[model samples]
Target chain A: MSASGRRRSQKYHQSTPYLFIAPFFLLFIPFGAGSVLLALGMSFVDWPLGQSPELVGLDKFATVLEDPLFGRAMRNTLYMLVGFLLALLPLCLLVAVLLKQLRRRTANVVQVVIFAPITMSLIAVALVFDLLYNERVGFVNGILDMIGVGPVPFLSDSDLAPWSIIALRIWRVLGYYAIILFAGLQAIPDEFYEAAELDGAGAWQRFRHVTFPLLKPVTMFVLVASSIAAWELFAEVDVLTDGGPARSTLTAVMYIFGASFEQFDLGKGAAASVVLAFAIIVSTVVAHRLLRSDDRA
Target chain B: MPKGSFAGRMGRGTVIGLIVIVTAFPLYWLLISSLKPSTRLGEVSLIPSSVTLGNYVAAFDTQIPRWMLNTFGIALLTTLLGVVVAALAGFGFARYRFRGRSLLFGVVLASLAIPEYALVLPQFTIMRQFGLLNTWAAVILPLAANALVLFLLRQYFSQLPEELFDAARLDGSGEFRLFWTIAVPLVRPGLGAAGLLLFLNAWNAYLLPLVMLTNSEQFTMPIGLAFLHSQLNFGIVEKSPWGAITAGTVISIVPLILCLLVMQRQFIGSLTAGAVKA
Candidate 1:
């Protein structure tokens, strides 16, 4: 009411926003931003656990670059990433499209069932898969035996190991990503389909000309999101394979984890982490560019 | 054929049925394998010939109860702290025009790029520095600063009508009061969604807990299972731990699966909301 009171309240309002927002920054600055910066600093030094870190600028990075295990990890990660995306993207789109045609209640129930795996502990899921993938006395091999196929070494044997891990990853996330694309499909009104039909377009044509184009944004989202997760592959491989049966399933994060925790080579771990981060960023950008370039044409 | 045709419907139905089976079978297997007798674990069967609670009884003999307690306690604390922090920040970013608003919000959004993998080493070092290693606080602290929760809540709060806040202001309500009485209650769905996501993420988290807590006594459910599993594989114990591993898997997942079932809409809806928007 009074001029001084009004001005004081105005001043208080400005600080109010900061008060509301300060908690996130309080946590973010020290934990979120600080740790990231600290990782960069840690990468430059020879920091073993429980000892003083010494500055050895770029040497850790060089060692990381030359480490054949690191190279193997990246290559395996890329191999799986491509396999994951190639398999996941189209499967998600197919599921979303089919799910779109189902009655609403039926669609929702199916979506929940499919999305259930993502909610479970990855370790628990890995254990279940490990049992399922076991060589002898395992369910998978039992079924193969029934069908006259030889017992497959899903977790053993270098060739089958990565694909086994990749299959596990796909099983967990297929429904989750599909549901997102399902929602994207839902947002595209029925009129789009009706109009396409009225124009004498067939089902495949309708999907190609209308559904596919409109769904690109969500597909791109799934592409980038799943690829990033794929690039940082760790827990499933670690628990199920330990990046093994000869390091066939070894991944970038597994490499980083081994460096930092197993060997206590924190500097090398941090450097590898930086390198992994760079790969994630570049691949993400390239994915965006790849998708975006197609948008115009 | 058009989707409306009978043949088309049959094909779609078959595919959907197969998808449901593939998705649901592992969970079903986890359940049945847990129920099988310990001696029969090596015997694969689509049906459990003899159901027994022996494995679950055996699971309790392990550190599972403590691990479950550790995981639920840590996840609950993370969800509580995470929701409150995100709500306040969401209200700020949505409701007020402050200096450094976009810049600060940009900083929050940018943190999502720093995945747990990248930050684990530094966070470990920092936790060790604070003398908090092998404690619940070590896991809860970093996870509580969740960028995704903030982003979700910010989107929720931003959609609220401005007139509600303006009316509260006219009643001489303080800024915090307006947020508490008006904006907070209005965003209950957002809160539920954010809380569920945070809880689920924390409960199922592996890497952070794996790195921070070294003591087996401090192990969360995932780490504990992994420990048992690795032990089983390496023959660290003479007798098999398969019985315990299968039973523990069931126990670890049941709570979150119940959560998912109860809040199925929010679980699916809010996640899709975040995915589409992000």
Candidate 2:
């Protein structure tokens, strides 16, 4: 090709990348980053529905902070997050380890069976759990009755409602996370376990020494991802309890939802959302740091 | 005991059996109860003596059919638009060395950390401002710009050998033709994976649609079902709505379940791949 022709083609190549990439930026700028900035701006102003916005600076945040219901929502979310991580981490780990022990065919079937729940809609899953937790016609209460135990108020009692909601969340997500960890486990060669056995390490020692450390990256991924999901708890609670039974299951998102939509207090909702986003970021950073510190050690 | 020993095998079998049953029983109950008489919802029996298709018939009479169509249309549009844009962007990032490329890519990845809840209110305001509220576009537009899909496809495109592109370019192939014909076909699996994620995310999305859509006709399956559930629980609907709920639940989930069964490898593979990379 001639020098001018080559120059033109080179220029075309330079511009082509921009043309290819422009579409994503076009949508993302107006929606993704734009929405976040808009939320940040909205958080500082008192924008009641159908009314002109008034800049209230940090007062909206202060109101959100002082609101007893927001406090409860955060507390409930934290309580459930702890319980959820406590239960889910070990259970999924156990499932992943046992899955590693099984033959490939058997493991695949078992994995699919357990992984099915994550595919189903949360609303449907919540409805199924609601029925199962029903006092009169539920299968769970029926079993409890046969065992001479009174029916459990899974969603009705404030104390149990959060845990009940957590259980449903765990059930839906267990296999999904476990499958991710299972893939992680599959990456750990059998040589490590065999070497541990040859060194007179028992199963527990093998796990403690060999499995846990190697699985840390995947485990950390699970920790951060699941905790983020835990923090954003809404749909399960919304469908199951509507943050009901004395607002026991009122998640941060639900509080935000109620404030913004039900009450039409967009500023308060935006403020609460800002707080929630900060919490999520801080927690994720903390988790990353904690895992990194352990990795160093 | 050793793994293959009798006690170990028995223990493993028992654990597997329990896990399968616990994980699967609720779905089983859902299927069975939907087939049972709606009037007998209070019955706690494990099995119904008689089966009826009445619940499904009753469900069809509701707005569920419309909700399903709305959700399907929205999810499909989101997937189609999301994948095309992502594919282009992914190819750009992988194959090009442009100014501010890293910064631009960083911006895209950073958006992943912003939870949907944080954006929903502002997105609602934007949609309302544009007079797009209560329309299918309201749901599809925001969801179509999915950062995760962009990230996943970028990872896929980055793995391709540059020699192929170079050879094609030397053959006087146009940039668009090279991407559309050579690069895209090479990354077909990635496209499938990205497409599946986008579709499922849009299909199962509740918060965005719930915030943007007020009319029942525009509600997605999740919102529609949640509405039905709340109505029944609050006693707004005195008659049995359990049948409709259960039947709707089944109809809503069956297609995705079938999709999972068929594409089990891709479903599991792509999810794991994304996490591992993340």
Interface RMSD of each: 2.0, 2.0
**Could you tell me which residue pairs clash in candidate 2?**
none
Q: Write the per-residue lDDT of candidate 1 for residues A1-297, one digit (tens) a residue.
A: 544467533634557888998887788777898999999999999988779999999999999999999999999999999998899988989999998888888887888799889888778878989778887657888788888996898988899898888899999999999999988888898898889999999989999999988988888889989999999889988888888878899999999998888898999999999999999989989998998898788
Q: Among all windows of ten consecutive residues in candidate 1 chain A, which has the lowest summed lDDT?
A: A2-11
TM-score of chain B of each: 0.95, 0.96
DockQ of each: 0.68, 0.67
lDDT of 2 by residue, B1-278 (tens): 12667898899889878988999999888888899887677666778888999999999999999999998999999999999999999999988889999999998889889888899999888888999999999999899998888899998999999889778877778899999999999999899888888888898898899999899989999999999887775564347578899999999999888887887777878666777787
**Cα lDDT of model 1 by residue, B1-278, tens digit:** 12587888999899989989988988888899899887776566778889999999999999999999999999999999999999999999987888899998888788787667899899899999999999999999899998988998999899999888766776778888888988889899889888887888899999999999989999999999999988876664337899899999999989877867887887788766767776
Full-model lDDT for every candidate: 0.88, 0.88
User: How large an RMSD does model 1 have?
Assistant: 1.8
Considering summed lDDT, which 10 consecutive residues are worst modelled in model 2 chain B?
B231-240
What's the residue-level lDDT of A206 in candidate 1?
95
- Taking the tens digit of each residue's C-alpha lDDT, what string does model 2 give over A1-297? 644478633634568899999998888988899999999999999999778889999999999999999999999899999999999999999989888888888887887788788888778789888778877667788788888997898888999988888888889999999999989988999899899999999889999999999999999999999999999989988887888899888889999999998999999999999999999999999999988898778
Q: What lDDT, from 0 to 1, does candidate 2 have?
A: 0.88
